[model samples]
Target: MDTAENRLNPPSQLLLALEVRGILELQAFFAAYPLLRYAPRGDGHPVLVLPGLGASDISTRPLRTYLKAQGYAAHGWKLGPNHGPRDGVEAGIDSRLADLAGRYGRKVSLIGWSLGGVFAREAARRAPELVRQVITLGSPFANEPKASNAWRLYEILSGRKVDDWPGREAMKLPPPVPSTAIYTRTDGIVAWQGCREQYSPTTQNIEVEGSHSGLGHNPAALYAIADRLALPEDDWSPFDRSGLRSMLYPDPLRSDTDSEAALRVSLAV
Candidate 1:
């Protein structure tokens, strides 16, 4: 549940215990692989996948593979592990985005998980013309710097205080391109509230059910990603959750308020 007060703090430690469920989500992904064929296919546009904190391209291989099978030319960040925008990271992603767009003669779509999503959003903002769209998985972009359990680890790896990072305020605004934020309230790392995007014509917030770490491979998340990627270059629209789809992807607008009310009741009890 998300509330202004709760948003001020990281998710409860009890939630971290749920991260181990990521293994189960992985198994589910493989089990559902056959069904993934029914997912929407893309137009062979270039897509770049970025990994999360402490993760290398290796972590995004499964996702990239799926995207490739869908006919998109998916590429990894290829910048080693994501250690929170070290000296060359910002420049590296910029160069990669420019090179891919230039080589393919098309704007590149970006899919990033966790900290990688943070980078993806920033990259899109830095060069909207080079970006087709941005999709983020469990990335804490719209909340306070300390609203994540990994802030300490981020400080250690990036050698910068969580609050002192550059562009902390500007990053909250949606990029100029179509953007999707896929998140889970059951997330074991960052607060789910921070993982949302502000309402906009080109931006959306999608809620799935899973651990924070498994979003990259979570079947629901994967399906949403595929659907978003399949949209024609200029035909972008909000994700449709009519009929049966509503059962899978909750209405974040309603659910957020409902969950907050539920939390208030629970606290009062």
Candidate 2:
């Protein structure tokens, strides 16, 4: 008895459907400028990026390359495409974080896209000592896991049930480390309101301009990530999207004031 209203489908938006074109723009932007020249150099900490559902490391190559150019040892989640909690995935993540931290003698920062962000948050919670910080792009980790337009497809692809994954409570719990969520109100895959973090000193959300799928390579998002990563581990501060940065990155909290009911629903779990 599944009807359109009850089925999980991507959010309907013409612009969101066209977000794939962002790749061309990204490539051109990188080619036109030595982007790394303006970026603050990192402290050579380890960074791990997880891919979205149905995407592999190849989709994250551009972001990883940019991070590497910024002086961080960025690595991809090499366990292939994310198809939910598949065999060896959780263990692989745990081992990967352990290996990177042990190898570099420093905690690793996690950057995850879409479903990958869900993985990042969980990993951070599981091993906060090994995680320096966590960032998520367009991940719908709250307000009922199945509320996302991508949920049914996720269930089909992963052969796992979203409802059975210990839903709402897990999504609402903040990771032990500093956490950031970068999402766009125009996201075509999930309800933007569901992607926000509970506002806190150690956690925040950034609203960007792009499609749900384009967040990985969105220049503004990259700048924000670099800005966050550049901070000293001991001197962590909330993202400063101030002045010029403010012009580019809108405050998600300010933008979502009209949707406080949804925010409350997200936190109820």
The prediction achieving the highest TM-score against the true structure is 1
lDDT by residue (147-221, candidate 2, tens digit) is 666788789978988776864576777788999999887676787767788877799888887677778888878
* TM-score of candidate 2 versus the correct structure, residues matched by position: 0.87
lDDT of 1 by residue, 105-224 (tens): 999999999999999999999999999999999999887888888999999999988888788879999999999999998777898888999899999999997889899999999999
All candidates: CA RMSD (Å): 3.6, 6.5
Q: Check candidate 1 and list the clashing pairs.
A: none
Give all TM-scores, in the order shown.
0.93, 0.87
What is the C-alpha RMSD, rounded to one decimal, of candidate 2? 6.5
Error of 1 at 104 (Å): 1.1
